[model samples]
Target: MGGQQSRQKHVALDDPESKYVIPQNTHKIKGLSRYMSAKADHDRIVATRGWDKHDENMQSMQMLKGLFKNLDPTVMKAVGDIRGDIQLSFKYDFKRQLLLIKVIRCRELPSKDWRSKMSDPYVMVRLLPDTNRQGEKKTRVVQQCNNPTYNEIFAFQLDELELMDMKLLVQVLDKDIISRDDVIGEVIIDMNTFKFKENPVHTAWYMLNKETDLSITGEIDITVAFQMPQSLFVTIHRATGLAARDEGNASDPFVKLTIPGTSVLYQTQVLKKTLNPEWEETFEFPIALEELEDRFIIFHVVDEDVSSSNDSLGQAIVDLKDFDPDRGMHGSYKLADLRNTERIRSKWFQRITAEEFSEALYAHSMSKQPSFIFQNQRTGKRVNCIVSS
Candidate 1:
């Protein structure tokens, strides 16, 4: 029995499939005891080798930590701070009503391409809740760099009222030529958290999170008179320094006025071959005085085309917050290019009542003295007389 058991243990050691064979001897048999002693020795050898390997791995990790400490402290600190995020700086100009953003840099970006181990990155910024793509601004792409330095600045025009609901969305994207761009991370900044008056320029590093579902997307000129109780009279007199849309000739321009949230749309006749086109057109809309505060007047200067679609020259937006019904408001407003958000041309305008117009005409016509010839017949005994006509 002892001989058979010894043979079985030797066979189990030789054959890989029989590694789970159990020992059969209960009492001290020389052959079976020798086999058991051999198995314990083999187990002890494996355990000692495993412990030695673990100590060697720990020593290598400690050496790596020492080498990293010898390198740049700033780089190490930044790497530790921004594990997977970006940094942004902000500035607000109350006088100009502009919100400026500076995308400083990005850190610790994940490798989008497994083979190349890097990503072509760019920054996209937009005002939140924008549906028309108007408030979107993008930075130029940086090639093949995980840690990109973009000292790029972007600006957005926002009024005091608009700032209340304004939120800025900053997105870090991986640029792909053939396929759609990949969004790596995003950060949304609430404008209300900033106290612009106290600190005009606020700079801070923000953690990049998941993308937002929100998205977004202009103008005109005229003399606007608000007649007490219910009447808005707009006169589009003329536009000067207008950008020519046609190649050969000057722009064939016209004016379009739109009162937002209402069915009111007014357009003037198109003038041919002129940069400075005069419409002299007056329009009236019945609007309650209370509703004036809630409405914005948009004047679009469009160039008429004979062969193709009409092109927009420029626009101007008018707010009636400071408008006085009795006094009225009138000036030459500089038209804004909504695409670039820059001032382009100026348009002359005036706002006045019907009675005021009649009075001014009467005063102008009566200003000059009337000619009389009672003296010419006697100019032989000439006497000249002035008469009011």
Candidate 2:
């Protein structure tokens, strides 16, 4: 346990339930979880939301337990005091087929290190593989040397990192050789890698495939959800790199999935780009519960119009049980990936997705209502509004 030693640990992903979802599914009432007893929030949600049946949903419940349990007791020293929560934000980089991590701090810090004399330390981050995408070859790691403050972050360039599983390991090494007794603050790995957040209006698509036939020979209409604070001129800026905005060459949008639940793979659409800022939006596409009359998915292929910064926009997955009412969506969620697309082994996901999905949604129900939890941007006051789903 050396203070400055580099220890590579397999980040055991605790599939804690999160309430955040896509498009309109994202809306919820804030502070709904607080009415329960300690560790009772998850159970409450399960009992009330039909999530108890799904083990994935249970994980969301377990995650809620872990979050409060993992919190620095000092932060919640007083009885009845609430704990710190995790937030998810996303930015689709069509050019790179990457989702940019955007987290705002309470106060801003300088971009470069030389400007201040604060005890800025080294924050190291690495991607941990999610079991679903475990079939792929190797994993990638990103080491950030001179990050500025607690607000400072370490990001993995998906293209360069090539981490198929997208699991992450984050840490802050007290590079301060002098302060061996470093009362160093924290190492935040926004588990929101799969769940990202953005203020500007954005779009995401969760699509479904036809369950009757397996051959993807016919044309597939991509199901898209456009979530925006306000509407404006929005179009695929080439379905490629956000860095290099081009419109002509891009992939056609297509949906893919796993029956009972589904996960969609957008063409170049995953790396969607837009020129406007100050817009907040989201989009979702649906997929078929069964393709070719079977319950499995390899990967969906959509033609594109241009090459991305890496020529591919990774992949997007969803819950099919949501589409088919009887599938019974459970679990918070447990995601896996592949270096390349293939027919998903039917056995792979049945184990954890239901529990993971259910628990995650229940846990998420508490935090999703930021309109009530966080203070107003201009006037520092907790907002209270009739935020309905």
Leading candidate by lDDT: 1
| Model 2 agreement with the true structure over 344-377: per-residue lDDT tens digits | 4222332244344445434555444222332344
How much is the lDDT of residue 152 in candidate 1? Answer: 94
Cα lDDT for residue 207, candidate 1? 64
Candidate 1 lDDT by residue in tens digits, 67-179: 22222233232222123567788888889988889998998887788889999999999997564356689999999989999999998887767876888888899999999
C-alpha lDDT of residue 61 in model 1: 30
lDDT agreement with native, every candidate: 0.62, 0.31
Model 2: lowest-lDDT 10 consecutive positions: 206-215
Instruction: Evaluate model 2: give its lDDT.
Output: 0.31
